[model samples]
Target: MAEGAFIRDVASFEGREVEIRGWVYNSRSSGRIHFLILRDGTGFMQAVAVQGQLPDRAFQAAGFAPQEAAVVARGLVRADRRAPGGYELELRDLEVLQGSPGYPLTLKEHGVEFLMDHRHLWIRSPRQHALLRVRAELIAACRDFLDSDGFTLVDAPILTPAAAEGTTTLFEIRYFDRSAYLTQSGQLYNEAAAMAFGKVYCYGPTFRAEKSKTRRHLIEFWMIEPEMAYCDLEQCLEVEERMVSAVVARVVERRRPELAVLGRDVSKLEKIRPPFPRISYDEAVEMLQRAGHSIKWGDDFGAPDESYISQQFDLPVFVLRYPAACKAFYMQPDPARPEVVLGADLLAPEGYGEIIGGGQRIHDLELLQARIREHGLNEANYGWYLDLRRYGSVPHSGFGLGIERTLAWMAGLEHIREAIPFPRLLHRIYP
Candidate 1:
């Protein structure tokens, strides 16, 4: 028995016998020869078996093997220009480890609903596999950029006593007879950590009980929130753009084949370097009106409005300084314009919508208390948050970037659901 090798590394064993253990992705048998396609999560390869060369049982196993059937094949690895990984297996012996008959999915096109229902199986498909590969790369790029920049990771709690955004969109739960809510964002806790570590970030899953069933929305998602002490709105924008550029470049470089599998234009991603176009909220409103969108100042722009604005740029666009009423209470009020906050939303191009949202946080104790009361939130729940501003708060800024949304944009996916492995939508939560 030859030592086993993955299909990806099978080329190294050329002209030598090796064992490959994987599930049969597909198989086709003629009268004298059979071709077996094998997938082991790493990659796929082809195995060939000739009737006269292998035992009768080996030929029988190869001829009638079912899709997803676990199998092991001892074969001589050979170079094949026509194979998936530029290598093929010449089977000398074969054994069916577990015959998986009647697999649910096929190599044909399936409806979105049907595929989503079988998401676990659907992920094995080429497109899903590629999409998720890029997603993993983007996450690594994010951590790489932040860690290399001297930011300490400070994890945020999932169960929080207070809402980071608002109560209306919170998922309420009972924790030992007391009401608690799933965290909407980790920006607030990152603020405290920033004071301790000077630069900090929180990367974890966050919950939003929003009833929105839009393609761009998810019930539960992962966000990366980075906070920096002595950072202002402009500086936050620079940091955000740099991070976005780094992640995009990484996905483009490492996941080029994956991007191509998803039909994404590499040129669009290559133009995603830093120095993305910037426009004030007022300017965005004006641009929207000129573009025939029925939006006005002080009103938050909807998907249609955002799509129109983002389409004006080749890369991500920064829309900054939104009206205070439309933003979270923790955002710092603009020193020059008290009615607006030093906030920003980074809208991805190609109509993918907002992928990041953040701003300078309020650092004055009195202002923080007033904003909390103004927003009609309970004061007792925010005592710890307010204490940060009371003791010694510097002008700090941060933002929350949704992992799924960013993945969708990078992979050119039609919906955010495909970006995450097991997505939680407003109406579906199983599997």
Candidate 2:
């Protein structure tokens, strides 16, 4: 137990003696020789203790009955190609710290319900560990992209008095004297900040009370949104492409090992580079109809339609300028065709639909007020928002990127639950 020695540092102590105190992952005894795989939170190491060659105390301590028993070992590190990590340890001393009884998750199959119930322990598994590592990389890549692009990171209020989008999916929480809802999107507040900072973004968790049972929906999820002042929908799409491309590039560069663990082909991610193909809502409807999908214009694309349209392109494709009636109240109407909104959805390839939803917002106070009234929303609730337009408003656009969905696609996970450590689904929310 040297002052500066960690379990991972054992590789540097190769061919020399060292001590690693950790829990046993598993152990196999073959009468004459014992092999124990130990993990100390930093890395895993294999320890070998031979009978008649070591003291009786060492052999007894290494003879773990159950897999997860805790023990400390003093051994000599040696390089061996037969070992998984190319390093092996010959034990000199052993101490049992804690004795573990029968474990639930063994080297066998379990039902999805059982696994979800034990998600607290399931994250320690190799697959989840690899998935979380990739998630960390994705978050870092997002921050890196926003920071490098001159976008200031601004945190929005979680508890709000009124809904910015609508009251349909609001998660109401009892406040001191009134009811408050979790912020669904930070776009409205980010728009106010954009007037001051020119470009601003918010990255945090959003909540919805709707009972959705789809692979693409989460009751609570993280969103990364960027708002640009004086920028139109075209400029917003350009930034979106660059930001997403930068994130994909970082994952490719840093998480090659993690991706390999999840059995993902890195080339699928490498195709996420610049100039993602763009198509209009009208074109998408036509393509879907041609592809045997019966989706007509003026209808929001469903999951099946999204998958069909996304399948046509190798990388993520942008479906822009949807019918204005289907969009949120904040979307700006197309000047040429007032029936279409200046919005876009970035649909990921491989059937990962709608990772990003964003568009230009109405800058004129009159138009915003008219849209609000037409949508049957209370004008009093949005008085402060309309003030942004009354004072000095410029064309601004932004988008929200769902973190869990993006991570699921990036990690090639079969389900979105695998991406989140503790998922809050419609039917279950525990541990």
Candidate 3:
């Protein structure tokens, strides 16, 4: 019986015979000599076989078919500088475990729709592997940063009785004769946990039923929500900058090989550090207007406006104190300018817009109630939430960062869809 080993572990088995099980990523034949590239999840390695050197059946099997065909190859590991991993397997035996029938995804270029339609197979590609590797590192970086800062990991509910933010974007379903909606953000729930834990965060999937199809929007995406019990908007922005910088630094440090594979410019990522540029909403609008943009004062900045503003700074631009009319009912109004809310949008460099949206929540019961009424929202739906304010609620602030959007920015990917494995978009939803 052959001892199963991973393709990445083949290096440790140099000059020793080992059995590697994997799907054939690609293969080539040269009359008497054959080369098979195997991918076993961890990584890939090449296996070389000679026609006369192996059994007749093995040689016949080596001449076989398409990419990603499952197979097990028994071979002796040998070091070669020319090979991908500085090593190659000299195949002594080969057998197909399972064969794929005319795989559609080839090494050649594929259309975006075609690739997305075949996402199950697309993840096996070098680019997708690189993106996923970066995603893992980014996630780990986020968790590590929060953990180091004395933040507890608290998981909130995915199915809830009522919507936390707004109902329009929620995906509701019937739950035991009552109505339930998939959570859009865990901020409100995490706020309750924060009162107990002081500082806590929730990282998980959040759903939104957005009807538009944009490069930055996703029907289902992961969000990282960090809530602090006694934090204000300024402190919140500080934590946000530090967390983002830590994630970028860790990704650059640990995933250099993967970044190189993706052809990302690491220098840009290396420049990400603390003290990101900050501007008030009024100032940002002024700057936009100075730059010949026709952006009005109160409206939420569109994609192009965000891109233009972000282009002015090397790091993310923290746009703060947006108009109260445009912000959510929960955001606290700026004391100096009563018309503006103490909310912010963290815009990533190079046109990646609004990776983080957060604010100082209205912790006062009367103010919250008034805002809810002012916004024409159903105050009855938020009775329990209002109770938090009535009973010892302290000043709090938090933010929700869409994981796929952040990953897309960090991985230097063109489309946000490429950052997630099984992306759910408006027009496309399938395997």
Candidate 4:
């Protein structure tokens, strides 16, 4: 009947009696002594029940409770170096609210498919819990960095009348009596907002219809896009490196325990600072050729190419000025070399490619209209977009940072699927 306490805060209440309401993570018994590992969402704690320390029924309940059984445990919090989270509870009473006998998941290893099938329950596992916690920390860090850097949060529409990236990767959906598609990126809308607010960002889910089974692709993912009104490519890159460094520093400082749970190499993350190495498209292609890749000048970098390029640097590397032919139509062409656009992709180190893609946008109405027509896109659908340039378009720059890919790289996850909760992939969309 003591005041309820979460395991995460039990350290401050050492020696005080409190009731922990949660599910039994694991249980074991050795004669009269019962050990119950309880997880109350915030953290895990080992609750010990001695036969004579409490009523017979309470001790029996502690011993017999199955894994994941809902329960309330009244106990005195104690410090124990060997226990999980460095805290233990001496149980005075135990009440099993629901017996979860024969839980579907066990201590044994399950196949990826089987685990994916049970992802709803699998997230309760410690590893999944840690990954999700780190993800939350990363998201918060990104928002904090952006907000503190004079960026206003402006929301963009999920249903769009046209594609922001390309038409091929759009997920078309029928609106009432017409057609609409899920948004690929919020960069366009963010540009409009930047004109109004000077500096703005839109954070939301984006959908892509790529049928990729690679470790980096997701059907639905979150993007953090920031646009600045009078920024150029160089200024954009400067903002990007600073924001990335700040976010990485925050995760390293506050999410150390979670990162440790994921077995992340914090040393590399600690080295993520400003002034990341920048290479021109020509330079990157030369490096690839020297490394024996068969890619040509205008070809976009694949996962392998990006990985190879990123691995050459200690910090995230910026590959700048991609060929205008392969980049988005809105990218501003370089004045000295009109063949390339003033855009860049920030490739994460250790083979996590292209976490952030952005660049200076075309502010000339005539050029933008020409580029749209050249790309075989309908100018009618983009009249409003061109109007931004028609009115008073200043030099603007922005980028979209894919949350899943960044988290996967930071957490050292093997697949992007684990970076998100309820991942919607090309083939799987179940619970």
Best by lDDT: 4
- Residue 391 in model 1: lDDT: 82
Give residue 194's lDDT in candidate 4 (0 to 100): 92
Model 1 / residue 170 / CA error / Å: 1.2
Scored by lDDT, model 3 comes in at: 0.88
Report the lDDT tens digits of candidate 4 across residue range 18-50. Answer: 999999999888989989999999988899999
Candidates arranged by lDDT, highest first: 4, 1, 3, 2
Candidate 1 per-residue lDDT over residues 1-431, each given as its tens digit: 69988876876889999989888999988867999998877778899999877899998889989998999988999998887778999999999988767888999888878888999998988788888889899999999999999999999999998788774589989999899999988888898899999999999999988899999999999999999999999999999999999999988998898999999999999998889999999999999898888888999999899988888889999999999999888899999999999999999999887999988999999998999999999889888888898888889999999999999988988889998999999889978
Q: Which stretches of candidate 4 lie over 4 Å from their true place?
A: none
Alpha-carbon RMSD, each predicted model: 1.2, 1.8, 1.5, 1.0
lDDT of 3 by residue, 35-91 (tens): 888888888898888877778788778778458888889988899987778889888
TM-score of each: 0.98, 0.95, 0.96, 0.98
- What clash count goes with each model? 0, 0, 0, 0
How much lDDT does each candidate structure score? Answer: 0.90, 0.87, 0.88, 0.92
